[model samples]
Target: MTTYYTEDHEWILVEGDQATIGISAYAAEQLGDVVFVEVPDVGTAFGQGEDMAVVESVKAASDVYAPVSGEVVEANQELEAAPETVNEDPEGKGWFVKFTLKDPAELTRLMDATAYKAFCDNQ
Candidate 1:
């Protein structure tokens, strides 16, 4: 599996044609204590960079964008009752959704782990 990241701080863990998506730990930390998350519904399709979900925190509410276009295959229903998981495990069980990638080529446009770390360091 390969992982990619958007400048907006969302990450996608790609496995075959499907990818699991989530906000990065940096984004979760910046957002502060997460209170709620609104994940996109299964079967929903979105263009790359589209607003796919909402994450609310004590600091503010933020839109979670699609790092790559695709049809939503599953959403983390566990978030509705345990949004704090985002703060605790932003890259793990806190994952927001899984989707079938619309264009696998799009993955090439995102940063890899090394590049993403450098990008964040500069920010």
Candidate 2:
């Protein structure tokens, strides 16, 4: 699997044409104690950079954007019951959605782990 990061602090873990989407640990930390998450339903399609989900925390409510165009295949329902999972494991079990990539080429526009770290460092 190849992982890509967006400037907005989202991450996409791509394995073949399937991708898992989530906020980075940096984003979870910034959000401060996630309380709720609204994930797109399966079959919902999103264009690159469009709002695909919403995350709310003690500090604020934030939109989680689609890093690339895709159709949602799964939404993490565990989040509805234990939203704090986002704080505990932002990139693992905390993932918001799974998608079937619409265009693999769109991934070329995202940052790799190294670039994303540097991008966060400057923020």
Candidate 3:
């Protein structure tokens, strides 16, 4: 599996033509205590960089952008009732959605883990 990061702080873990999507640990940290998560429904299509979901924290509600264009295949329904899972495990069980990738090339435009770490460092 390979992972890519968007400037907006979303992460996509690519495997074959599917990717699991979520915010990074750094983003979860910045968002504070999450209280709600709203994800796109399965079968919905979105463009790269589109607002695909919402994450609400005690700090504020924030948009979660799609790192690449794709059709939503699955959404993490568990988040609706237990959004704090995002704060506890942003990259693991806290993942927000899964989508069928629209363009594999788009992944190249995103940052790798090392670059994302550097990007976070600069922020």
Candidate 4:
């Protein structure tokens, strides 16, 4: 699996044509104590950079955008009852959706881990 990151702080773990999407740990920290998450339903399709989910926290409600074009295959239901998982493990079990990539080429526009870290540091 390879991981890619968006400028908006979303992460996508790609494995073949499948991908798991989530907010970065940095974004979860910035949100401050996530209270709720609204993930797109299975079969929902999105273009690269479109808002695909919503996360609400003590500090604010934020939109989680698609890191690349795809169709939702799964939504993390665990978040409905325990959104704090985002704070505890934002890059792991806290993931929002699993989807099939619509265009693998789009990934080239994203950042690798090193680039993402530098991008965050400058923010």
Candidate 5:
């Protein structure tokens, strides 16, 4: 499935009814190589726009937000072993978590590919 992005720069690709979430290439590039990822524990509930993880890079730390209100279902444990994957493949291998979306309406707040491009251009 193709991914959608939030103005905050989080990305989520829905598969079936669940979605896998991550930071975008724009975010990873700005952060540089990832050093650590603080993924939410499984079962933690989050509201849309809530900060869920702390992505630590060589330069600084940034919060990764929840694009849709949901319960965290899975975290990418691979990030603990090789956080650099976020820089290597921010959209693919770098996915951060998976969640069961609680409110599908939250998706309406996200940006589509074209709109995201405009948002990035303004930044």
Candidate 6:
């Protein structure tokens, strides 16, 4: 499966009906050493582009959005213990949550890695 990224700096990789979500590496770099992550409770629902969590860094607080409408199935409780993982590895160990996708077609609204890189460049 491929990953899709948003203008809000969120990234998602959809595999089957589930998607793993997180802030982009660029966003983590800008946030400057993540300190805490305020996340939604598992089983809560959010719409596409909805604000589901807030990631706080030494520099600022950034919102984490739902790449597609879905119910949050799992969260990274590890982040509450060590949010710095976000800054250390935005794509891997840093992933914030997993959700059951609402509409798989909404995945088309996002940019692929190549497009995400261009979007970052334009910003």
> TM-score per candidate, in order?
0.98, 0.98, 0.98, 0.98, 0.95, 0.96
lDDT of 4 by residue, 1-123 (tens): 999999999999999999999999999989998999999999999999999999998777899999999999999999999999999999999999999999999999999999999999999
lDDT of candidate 1 over 16-44, digit per residue (tens): 99899999999999899999999988999
lDDT of 5 by residue, 40-102 (tens): 899999998889999998788899989999988999999999999999999989999999988
The runs of at least 3 residues in candidate 3 whose Cα sits more than 4 Å from the true structure, single-residue gaps closed, are none
- Checking candidate 5 for backbone clashes, the offending pairs are none
What local distance difference test score does each model get?
Answer: 0.96, 0.97, 0.95, 0.96, 0.89, 0.90
- Across residues 41-74, which tens digit of lDDT does each residue of candidate 2 receive? 9999999999999999877889999999999999
TM-score quality measure for candidate 5: 0.95
Better lDDT candidate (5, 6): 6
Cα lDDT tens digits, model 3, 41-101, are: 9999999999999999886889999999999999999999899999999999999999999
Tell me which residue pairs clash in candidate 4: none
lDDT of 6 by residue, 1-123 (tens): 779999899999899989999999999988887889988899999999889999997767778888889988999999999899998999998998999998999988899999999999988
Model 4 scores a C-alpha lDDT of 0.96
lDDT of prediction 3? 0.95
